[model samples]
Target: MFDLLIQYEWMRNALYAGVIIGFISPLVGVYLVVRRLSLIADALAHVTLSGVAAGLLMQKEVAWFQGVNPLYTGMFFSLAGSMFVEKVRSLYRSYQELAIPILLSGGIGLGVVLISAADGFNVDIAGYLFGSILAVDEGELTLIAGIGILVVLFFLFFYKEMFALSFDEEHAVLTGISRKIINLLFMLVVALVIAASIRVVGILLVSALMTIPVAASLQFTNSFRQTLIWSVVFSQLAVFSGLFAAYYLDWASGGTIVLVSVAILLLILAVKRIVRIFRRNPVS
Candidate 1:
């Protein structure tokens, strides 16, 4: 199985991209989860699907677009969607959560229309919807690497501000943190992560990679830093194991990865339950 990496360029690219996404998704997800903004990832992912469909449609009808990558278009849409969400949220201050569902519905509707227009691209579209290990190419790997670096830098420079905001928005604002600017930048970063991860986990399942590992880490972690560390560890474990299972079992890579993360979460819950019971009974 390990030999596949050295023997096939696609395999190597998938591995590299998966590792980068595995780390960064959870890195950003920690803050989102703490702030109860996990749904934003799902919304951006649906918007990205529309962009991908648009790219596919152009490729079919336009000569110049034949050489363009759909992932680029998907990234553009994801970023645009993020900005829209922020704008809408501002307009509905008392009902800010409404922004996510509105965008999610609009994105899905637009994506369906674009996909219908493209027609005859079921196979290619499936790759974007459910993920294909073979779909990743060298160009996409470079894009993923660049986005990964940008996410890292954003976190490094604004770690404290992000932390403060996540735990207590009101106090953070009083402390002079620029909520509006930070939030806009954070949404953009989330969009980038969703776009970069589409090849590894697809648009439909990308949010799972971002949130599930953080969910698992929260079970045992006592500190914010600990949650971040454990989330990355669990995410890497899921990515590597899920890729191996997908390769050997011929399963959808996105589904397999999500199932592994879910399995990890269940396992942690079971262990915690058993420990609680043991603590109550002790050794007679």
Candidate 2:
């Protein structure tokens, strides 16, 4: 099974892309979860799907776009969607959450239209929708690596500010943190993560990678920093195990990865429950 990496360039690219996405997705997810903005990832992912469909359509119909990577177009759309989300959120201060669903619906509608126009890309589109172990290429792996580096640097520079903003937006603002600027930049980062992660986890399941590990980590971790560390640990574990299983069992890579994360979450919940029960009725 392990020999597949040595034999196939696609497998190696998938593994490399998975590792980078596994690390960065949860890193940003921790912040989103803390801020109670998890749904934004889902919205951006849908928007990315539209961009991907558009790219596929253009590639088939226009010679100039034949060599372009759909992932780049997906990134462009995801970023544009993020900015629109922020703008819409500002317009409805009392109903800010409405922004997510609006974009989500619009994204799906546009994606369906574009996909219909493309007409015969079911196989290629399936890879984007559900992730394919063979869909990642050398160029995509490099793009994922670049995105990983950008995410790390963004966190390194803004860690303190993000921490403050996540835990208490009102106080952070009172202390002179620029909520608007920070939020816009954070959304952009999330868009990038979603676009990059789609190749490993697919557009539909990408949010799971971003949120589920963080959810599990919060169960036992006592501090924000510890939670962040454990989230990445759990994510890596899921990616490794999921990829192995996907390879051996011939399952969809995205579904396999998300199910593995879900399994981890369930196991954590069960353990926590048993511990609580034991604490209530100490060994007699």
Candidate 3:
């Protein structure tokens, strides 16, 4: 199964997409977890689903969209949805989390309508739900790679500011970090990451790719930067293992990946408990 990367273009594209998502998802996800805004990824992913559904429905109904890729539309709507969330958050500052549920519901509603219009779900749409080994084409691999680079560069450039905002928004504001601008930019970056990851992880489970590894990492890390590093490490482990399982065992890639992530988190908790018990009762 591993050797297929050299033998098939589809396998190579899958590997590339997985690695890109492995790196960026947890990298950005660490900050999201710290800020207690992890649900935002789920909301944006649902929005992306609407866009993807629209693209698929259009391909079926309109002649022009036959040649168009659904991922492009997914990215556009994800970005727009991120901005909408930001606006709604500002409108109800005392209840900021309301925005995520609102967007999530709206996205799911739109996606259902579009999918129904396209005559219900088919194999092509199933790929976006549970993921497919061959779902990503050459162009999408290139786009995912490009988006990975941009996300890394932006994260590095705004590392300190992001940290400040994540840990203490009031302090970030006091430090003149331009919280509004940085937050909007971060949301946009996160939206792009979600759109890019859906090719491999699928829309429904992509949030797990973002948050589960971070949850596991928090069990072992003492510092914020260290947490980010561990999250990416655990993410790579899940991605690689899940990809291997999906390829050889005929499993649904998204579900396999998320279940692997959950397994890792549980393993980490068990390990930490054992270590604490051992320290408390050192042998003679």
Error of 3 at 75 (Å): 1.0
After the best TM-score superposition of candidate 1, give how far the Cα of residue 16 lies from its true spot, in angstroms: 0.4
Q: Give lDDT for model 1.
A: 0.91
lDDT string for model 3 (28-132, tens) is 899888888899999999999999998888777789888988888999999999999899989998998998899899999999998887787554777887677
Q: Pick the candidate with the highest TM-score.
A: 1
Instruction: Identify the runs in model 2 with alpha carbons over 4 angstroms from their true place.
Output: 1-3
TM-score on alpha carbons, each prediction: 0.97, 0.96, 0.96
| Better lDDT candidate (2, 3) | 2
lDDT of 2 at 41: 96
- Expressed as tens digits, the lDDT of each residue in 31-141 for candidate 1 is 989888899999999999999988888888999998999999999999999999999988998888898898899999999998887766744688898887556889999
Instruction: Kindly state the number of residue pairs that clash in model 3.
Output: 0
Poorest 10 consecutive residues by lDDT, candidate 3: 121-130
Q: How many Å off is the CA of 267 in candidate 3?
A: 0.7
lDDT of each: 0.91, 0.91, 0.89
Give the higher-TM-score candidate: 1 or 3. Answer: 1
